[model samples]
Structures are given as C-alpha cells and as structure tokens.
Target: MRKILVVEDEDAIREVVALNLRLAGYEVTEAASAEQALAVFSPSAGFDVAVLDIMLPGMNGFSLCETIRRDSASIGIIMLSAKTLETDKIKGLSIGADDYMTKPFSVSELLARVEALVRRVGRQGASSAAPEPDGRMVSGVFVLDQKSRVLYKNGTPIDLTQVEFQIMELFFANPGVALVREKILEGVWGENYFGDVKIVDVNIRRLRMKIEDEPSAPKHILTVWGYGYRWNA
Candidate 1:
C-alpha cells in the first residue's frame, strides 16, 4: 500500500481528509502540527506523499516541506493553504512542493492530486533503478544520467526535484519542440491531475533557477510568449 502523511492543525479538516484518504485505500498517517510530523517522518519509511497545511501553529508547512524535501527528493509534496495568492503558490513550489491547493477545495480534488503525485513518485522511483541501454543524454553542459536520476552540469551534479527531473526528461525527449503549457502539464503531472495549469510555469521557473546561468534571463528553457516554452538545446 502507498503511504501518505497528512499534517493539518484543524481537527475537522484533518479528520475529513484522513477519512477520505483511508477510505480510498491509502496507508494514511495524521499529524496535527509540523512538530508532530517531525517526530514521525522518516525517509526510509518510504512515504510516497505528504499533504501539509500552511497555517500550522509552529514550524509552518513551508518549513516542514523544505526539511522533508532536503532529506528525500523522491517523496512527493503537496501544500495546502487558505490563501490563493500567486506568490504563495510560487513560494510553496520554489521551496519544494510538487503541487499546491487552496482551501475550500473539494476532497475529490485533493484525492486526485494525491493520486497523481503518488503515481509520479512511483514511476520516477522505478525508472531510477534501471539504466537505459543508452545511459545518458547530453545537452550542452547538461548530462542526464538515467540510471542515477541525476542531472550533471559541467561535471557537477545539479540537484533536481522529482517533478523537475520529469520535466527535464520530457524536454530532452522532445528537443526543439515548442511544448504548450497543457502538454507539459500532462506530460509531467499526468492526465488525472486536478491542480491549476500554472503549476507548469512555477516548476519551470524553479527548474531554471537550478539549471540556467541566469533565471531572470533564461537561455536554455526559453519561453514562447503567447503560447508555451521550448528547450533551446
């Protein structure tokens, strides 16, 4: 069974989320705060997803997400917030979350995002274990090592989140193709995803920070204004 951690301070909301997740057949663990989560979360425990609320009493969800992500890049993270501001969404994604959902969201939507994240995490994990017959794909200064799931830039390995890694895979596979935002979204987040399409934009921004010489003026991951983005390599 896939394991999930749900950290929400509100009892009712947490209970509802946990109940639905359990009913959906996930191995669910609940925490009322980030402190509680810290006590229980273990990378080796093999948690596939973490659903964290931003308004915790202490050590907010953003911090918890960062801590967990620093330890396990493969684990999928989803952030919850009552605020729908684009900056909040960007900050959450920049920190480490693979997905974000604002409050007043339906349980069904949350479940769908969790399901999509879990599938992505599983697929990425499986792919990392086996080396492709052609081990690496070289693009300028970048070297994507399929077996280790690591991207090397000029001999230095650039750390990539699971989502960013998948995006890189898609870009490398379709070089010079002007991929629309929806196509990128479906390619990385899967077709069953229920989150906003802007997620593609946020993740691309984050990925550029890691890979590009200057994120403010990206050269490789060029934006095709009025449409989408294309990998220049």
Candidate 2:
C-alpha cells in the first residue's frame, strides 16, 4: 500500500483526513506540526504523498511544503486551507504544492485530487505500449534526451528533478527565444497565475549548478536583461 502523510493541527480534521486516507487503502501517518512532518517526509521518506493543512501553529504549511520539496520530488503534495484568497493558492502552488483545496472540502473530493496527482506523475514516464522516440539536442557538452527524461554532459548523467526537466524541455522547445518568467511558470508549473518570479530564479540557479561550468557566466542558458531567460540550443 502506498503511504500518505497527513499534516494538520486540528485533531478532528487530522483524524478525519487520516481515516479517509486509510479507507482509501493507503498507509496513513499523521503529524500535527511542521517539525513532526519534516521528521517523517525526508528524502528517505516512506510516504508517497503528503496531505498538508496550511494553517499549522509554528512553521505553517507553506514553509513545510518548501522544506519537503527541497528534500524529495517523487512525493505528491496537496495543500488544504481555509484561506480561499487567490494569493494564498498562488503562494501554495508556487512553492511546489501539487494541489490546493479550500477548507470545508469533502473527503471524496480530496481523495479524487490525490488520485489525479498520482496519475499525472505516472504519465510523465513513457509507457511500454507507447514508447517515446529517441532524440537529442546538444549545447556544448550538455545533451538532453527528451523521451527518457535524461540529461548527459560528456556521457555522464546529470541529476535533474522533475521541475528541472520540465524547464529544460521548455528551453529546448523554444531555442534562442526569450521565455518570460510567467510563461515558464505556466508551462513548467502547470499554473502561472502566481505573481512571484523568484521561483524561476531559484530553479535556474539549480539548473546552472548542474549543467554550467561557471554558473555566474552561463553559456547555454542565458538571462535576458529586464525580460526572462533563454537557451542557446
């Protein structure tokens, strides 16, 4: 059974969420605080998804979500909160929360959201019945294999998280063109309604650390002044 970690401060809500997840045939773990959630959702974590509540006591769900994202990429994250403002939703999704739900939500709806996220993650891989074709695009020593989600520099594999892979895909698809921060977010994050552009900077820094010889003087992925970023292709 796939495991799910539920992080909610309210006892009643936490128990109810746990009960529903368990009923859905998942091994459920409960954490009432951000500190506890971190202890449970590390890189060597057991859970497959995290159902996190946004209104926690100390660290709050947003901070916890960022912490978890920094640790692992395979796990799904769904943020639950009573805050229905668009900004709140944007904040949650911008930091790598997979799905956001407003409070007073139905158990069935949450279950469906979880299922959808898991299914979407699975589809990123090429199926045996419909294998992805081989193609390569090279920029100096760095090479990208789109079908297999692999990046190689001089024949050695470069480790990229799923988000990084998507960013590279965007750059490859639109070579030599400036991709605005919002456009990259929409294409890569599945929703760019959020206003913050710093997330783009953070991911680009990560990509450079892996692919560029001198990140400060990037050759392939270049920054366009007052605009966005571009790939030399």
List the candidates' TM-scores in order.
0.94, 0.63
- The TM-score, computed over Cα atoms with residue i paired to residue i, of candidate 2 is 0.63
lDDT of 1 by residue, 1-233 (tens): 99999999999999999999999999999999999998999889889999999999989999999999998889999999999899999899888999999999999989999999988988853332233567887777888887688899899998888898888888887778899999989888988778788889888998999988899999999999988999986
Summed over model 1, clashes come to 0
In terms of lDDT, which candidate is strongest?
A: 1
lDDT by residue (1-233, candidate 2, tens digit) is 77889999999999998998888888999999999988767777656788999989999999999898877765778899999897897788767776788989888878876765555455463222222245565555667775567788889998666667768877866778899988887765545232346657767877888888898999888999888999984
**lDDT for model 1:** 0.89
Return the clash pairs for model 2, or none.
none
Once fitted onto the true fold, the runs of candidate 2 whose alpha carbons sit more than 4 angstroms away are 127-142, 145-233
Error of 1 at 19 (Å): 1.4
Every candidate's lDDT: 0.89, 0.77
